[model samples]
Target: MSTDHQESVQELDVRDVDGEPFEQIMNALDSVGESEALRLVNSFEPVPLYDVLSKKGYQYDTEQVADEEWHVTIRPE
Candidate 1:
């Protein structure tokens, strides 16, 4: 038998949290125990930023939001 407890995407709004600065968001992640929740960033940059975050061991998923914007969901590894 299969269970039906669908885990919906928990969207932690970045505008309300990060504002714009990535550093401040990282700090917030640290304070809140990164593993406890996920973070979503609304930005378009693909390579450089994702590269840095990957190197830091943050597992993330991305989706296109607009013409040049994307929404990234970040979670702890």
Candidate 2:
């Protein structure tokens, strides 16, 4: 997969979820396709997750749309 911009993606919003959403996020990423992406919506930027994703051959871009809103688009590299 070229990892080009993909329209087909899975969006997982964890803003109102209870407890930690790490496992939930991981599971979501696990099901993501090679040519697709995982859009994570959260209350804060998941900076620590960058390393984990990078190690898994994935790259991500984080954008803070609001004081407590962040969006990370994860794509396979």
lDDT of each: 0.61, 0.90
TM-score of each: 0.57, 0.88
Q: Model 1, 1: alpha-carbon shift in Å?
A: 17
Clashing pairs in 2: none
Per lDDT, the best of the predicted structures is 2
Q: Identify the runs in model 2 with alpha carbons over 4 angstroms from their true place.
A: 1-6
Residue range 1-77, candidate 1, lDDT tens digits: 35366333445455554345667657755654433545555555445567767887777778887875667776666
TM-score, candidate 2, is 0.88
Superposition TM-score, candidate 1 onto the true structure: 0.57
Q: Which candidate is the best by TM-score?
A: 2
Query: What are the runs in model 1 whose C-alpha is more than 4 Å off?
Result: 1-20, 32-35
